[model samples]
Target: MKILFLDQSGKPGGAELCLIDIAKPYRDRALVGLFADGPFKTLLQQNQISVEVLTTQSIQVKKSSSFLQGLKSLRQIIPLIIKVVKRAKGYDLIYANTQKALVIGAIASFFARRPLVYHLHDILSKEHFSQTNRRIAINLANYFASLVIANSQASQTAFVQAGGRANITTVVYNGFEPKIYQTCESDVRQLQQELGLIGKFVIGHFSRLAPWKGQHILIDALAKCPQQVTVILVGDALFGEQDYVQQLHRQVTALGLKNRVNFLGFRADVPQLMAACDLVAHTSTFAEPFGRVIVEAMLCGTPVVATKAGGAMELIEPGINGFLVQPGDFQELAQVITTCLHERHKTATMAHNARKIASQHFDVKIINQQISQLLSSKFN
Candidate 1:
């Protein structure tokens, strides 16, 4: 079946990365469209997926107190929407990879006479989005979406609670190409040297540097961790969170963790970095729709400690596969880290169990087949 996949993000986050898996199996018949060009475009090309950059599609759905300003931006986007609607005519279905994608793809679907499948990755609540944004999302989803594919059951529940149709929604976890993410031994050694972590135990925070990601909380936990342990933050700012990023840096310095903390900006080598780290930390201050890093770490045979947020409970078995602490609780996180470090004999066993979990349910091959079956029977 011919499918048109749309994503309005410019940066390559976990959602964008998993989107590569979603489109990979359909590479022969699908068109993967991006709002703008970035590393995600490069990834799609590397996977042999047909990619097109619709430069006029903007990621910034303008959020302002003034309704007039918002209308102005929408007016500016009218020509772009017309272009997308025209392009969607050849597709059998429109797969929206994100919320912004849904906004555009749903409109395109109406114009193109196609079904729109919205891939919902975020929890739509007053806590997660602004009041106006939440209302807009609910109205749009109810009016235009044919199906909603949530990243986790928690996200699915949130969508329905926010007035999204429950019957038309399904939860599909993110999948990983394990082979592509495997790290070479030489690269691990080089990474260790580069981070000055020759003899230190590294705890990695692998996600975008947004305020809700809890980078500052990780630093607080690190302040109480053993001296031999170091925190390695792996990601770049993907939104208007530059002030939060600067605040994190200031807090790290104020807490006297300059030597113990290292910011390794956005790296395409996540699996490699996961291999080099002693432990993975998913320290989001709020609920995450899904913890892709946790699954990726588990697939790489690494143990993780995550906040007991949206999908963390689903991914972590708590003291079996990994640990889960309350979001923003530095003391609890510190205690868990200490327990993990002290119990080195059990780390490998936990990692082994983690891989078993990944293989059983989170493998890309298995997930792609499931998606294809669903699309064929329903969407086709």
Candidate 2:
């Protein structure tokens, strides 16, 4: 079946990365219509996937945008709506991958007479979005979307709590290719030597450097850990969160962790980097819709310690596959890190369990099949 997938990001976020896997099966018969042009479009091209940048103007709406602000941005997106409406007629479905995409795709689906699928990637909580934005999103999906594919049960629950139609929503975790994470031992050793991580216990944080991502929390936790436990932050600020990045740097310096922390901003070889680390951390201050880094680390046979909230609670089984710590609790986070560092045999066992579970549940091929089946069932 032909599909037209819509996304608003110019850079690759968790949702955009998830879209890559979901769209691959339909590559020959599908098109990904992006709202802006940047590295994301380039990455899609590298994957040989059909993609196009549908707009040059940025949508002037934020997660905290008021109703008037949202309405004002509507004028700018009219041409984009027309374009998508026209193009969507050739496809069987319009799949919206981001919140802004949902707004446009819902309208396009109405005009194009195609079914709309809204991929709910964020938790519509007051902590993450303003009440106005949450209402707009929930109301639109409830009225227009034929199906809502939530990234986790937590996301789906948040939608329902915010008055979304429960019947239309279903949980579908982000998928990964376990094979991609199977890094060679020689490569891991070489990277360790190259990064000057020869004998240190490396703790890796793999999300974009944002305040809500809690990179500072990790830094705080690092201050309480042993000097031998070092951290390597593996991503750059994607949005206008440069201030948070600067704040993190200041915090690192203030704590005298300048030598213990390595800021390896945005690298493409995430799996290899994750494999080189002794442990991976997910320290989001707010509820994560889904912790992609947590699963990515698991797939790499690496132990993980994530914040105990939102989708993270769904992914980990404490002391089994991985460990979960309370959000913002640096004391607990530090304790867990120490535990992983001290108990090498037990941590290795947990890492093995994490890899096995990740391979079974989150393999991209399995998830794509489920998504394909869902689309077919809905269309029929």
Candidate 3:
């Protein structure tokens, strides 16, 4: 079936990466319309996916945008909305990959008389979104979307708690290919040597540097851990969070972790970096809709310690496959790291179990099959 997918990101976030997996099966018959152009567009081109930049302008609306800011962005997006509507008429369905995309896709679906599918990637809660934004998202999905595909049970639950239609929403975890994370042993050693982490216990944190992402929390935890522990942050700031990045640097210096922390800003070699790490930490202060890094660490056969909330709770069973710590608790996080450092054999066993479970449960083929069935049963 022909599909038109819409997304509003210019960078590759967890949701954008998930969109790539979802759009791959429909590549031959799909057109991905992006609201802005950047490395994500280049990524689509590299994958041979049909993509076009619908607009060069940025949408000023944010998750915490006030009502006035939302109104202003509405005017800015009118031309883009018209374009999406025109393109939607040629497809069987309009799939929205992000919240801003949903706003335009929902309207386009109504105008073009096509079914709308919204992939809900964020929890619609006060922690992540303003009340105005939450209401707008739920109302739009309820009125215009034919199906709401939530990335986790936490995201779906938040939607329902915010008065969304429970019948229309379903949980679908992000999927990955296990083979992609299996880096060659030589490459992993080279990476570790290049980063000066040869004998150190490397702890990797792979998310954009943001306040809610809890980079500072990891730095705090690092201070309490053994000196052999080192953290390599793999992502850079996006969405005007540069101040937070500066704050993290200051925090690391003030805590005298300057030699132990390495800020390796956005790199293309994620799997290799993950493989070089002895442990991966997901320290988001907020309730993450889905913890992509946690699953990625598992697929890479690296032990993980994630904040115990949102989708993280679903992905990890403490001491079974991986470990969990309470959100924002630096003491608890440090204890988990210390435990993994001391219990080498037990940690390796859990990593083995994590890889096996993640390989089977979150395979991309299985996830795509589920999406296809949902579409066929609902649209066909």
In angstroms, how far off is 123's CA in candidate 2? 0.6
The positional error of residue 309 in candidate 3, measured at the CA in angstroms, is 0.5
lDDT (CA) per prediction: 0.83, 0.94, 0.94
Over 4 Å off, model 3: none
Instruction: Give the least accurate 10-residue stretch of model 2, judged by summed lDDT.
Output: 235-244
Candidate 2, which segments miss by more than 4 Å at Cα? none
lDDT of 2: 0.94
Number of clashes in model 3? 0
lDDT of candidate 2 over 52-164, digit per residue (tens): 99999999999999989989997889999999999999999999999999999999999999999999999999998988999989999999999999999999999999999
Residue-level lDDT of model 1, residues 113-175, one tens digit each, is 888888888888666876676667777777888777888988998888988888888888888
Better of 1 and 2 by lDDT: 2
Candidate 3, residues 48-134, lDDT tens digits: the string is 899999999999999998788899987778999999999998999999999999999999998999999999999999989998899
lDDT at position 293, candidate 1: 86
lDDT of the structure predicted as candidate 3:
0.94
